[model samples]
Target: MTNAKTLGQAFDVLLQPDKFRDYGPNGLQVEGDREVKLLVSGVTASRALIEAAIEAQADAIFVHHGLFWRGQDGRIVGWMRERLRLLLTHGIHLFAYHLPLDAHPELGNNAQLGRLLGWQADGRFGDQDLGFLGVSTQPWSRPQALADHVSAVLSRPVTCVGDMGQQVRRVAWCTGGAQGYFEAAIAQGVDAFITGEISEPQAHLARETGVAFLACGHHATERYGAPAVAARVAQDLGLQHRFIDIDNPA
Candidate 1:
């Protein structure tokens, strides 16, 4: 069985939180079990997810989204209180890597998406709080082809707008809730953009922007980074690890 100190140390090295200035505390949000063996990895630290970690008997819950943002209320109440109560009651560790997971050069969400879609390594495009834009190696085949590739890889359903067969040479992607960047991608002359969630205005924005848009499920798209990070940590630290993906259809 792993102790809390060793687990925390391994996560610090694995996540490298100093590199990305995140909105919330990026590492060890709620400390519980030290020597972690079973790890529950997911997109967010919702109440249900916390319960899942408990049900799985996990020592650590690793996720992309964790509690305690920069400006949010620090009080424990409502949903926050319930989440904390669950963790504390179970002695389950909560570890989150926010911007660090998104911006990591290799293991990040953007990086993995680019690699899966065969995009070449290019630097970031822009920022909203903190984000990056990636480039495609070869020009896009068609919007539908790209969308099909994304849906297959992410294993989540998708919603697409704009011409399916439009020629796509450039792509702008921000993993979760990045519809606001529709205009940003347009300004950059990107032919297509992908994000986790979409709003009603986003459909019109895609039409106005004349860019192919894909709304891949937020949970589906972000699941890779946590498990990849987990595997890396296990390999490097020689610790037993498992990434539990609690399904969220959204």
Candidate 2:
């Protein structure tokens, strides 16, 4: 068992949440028990995940996406109220890290995804250096080959927006709804850009610039960071840890 504040402090030290200007609060969004023995980690703190945590008797829940965000309705009602009620009723602490989790060199989503796909990050690009510039360790000569590899690894159909014959060597990527960074990645002279989602303009841009684009599912790409960080923290703090993957098709 460990003090809840100590766990939070450990995460703050490792992730440095304050360094990123994120869309939502980055740490300890909901307070619960003062002590935590078991930690549950997941991609998002949706109702299903919370219920699973409850079932597992987790004292705290760590996630990449939290219950709250900027520009959202401040009032606690509807789905928000229910989520809050469950946490409060169970006395489960809620901790979330967004951009900080994404940007961490080793434990971040981009880094973990790169490691999973055998890509090497050589540099960073885009806003706050959230996007990664990398090269595939294996020579994926064609866009289709890279897309096929991504699909097989992520277990979800990848959406490719470029000619199959396009030669792909250098690559850039940012996980989770970062299609806006495509042009910035293009400027870096990468042959391909991979992200969790793609927008309409990206298709046109891929055609015009001949830069291949791949949209792996947002939830699929971000599944690693929270669990990886949580497991390390749990090991360091001598607390039990469980990662519950509530599958999300998005």
Q: Considering every candidate listed, which one attains the maximal TM-score?
A: 2
Tens-digit per-residue lDDT, 67-127, candidate 1: 8789998788998999999998888888888877876778877777677777765546657
Clash count per candidate = 6, 0
Off by over 4 Å in 2: none
Clashing pairs in model 2, backbone N/Cα/C closer than 3 A:
none
Estimate TM-scores for all models. Answer: 0.86, 0.98
Candidate 1's C-alpha runs over 4 A off are: 128-140, 163-165
> What is the C-alpha lDDT profile of model 2 across 1-250, one tens digit per residue?
7877899999999999888998999989999965899999999999999999999999999999998899999999999999999999999999999999999999999999999999999999999999999988997999989999999999999999877787888999999999999999999999999999988899999988889999999999999999999999999999999999999999
- In TM-score terms, candidate 1 sits at 0.86
* Best prediction by lDDT: 2
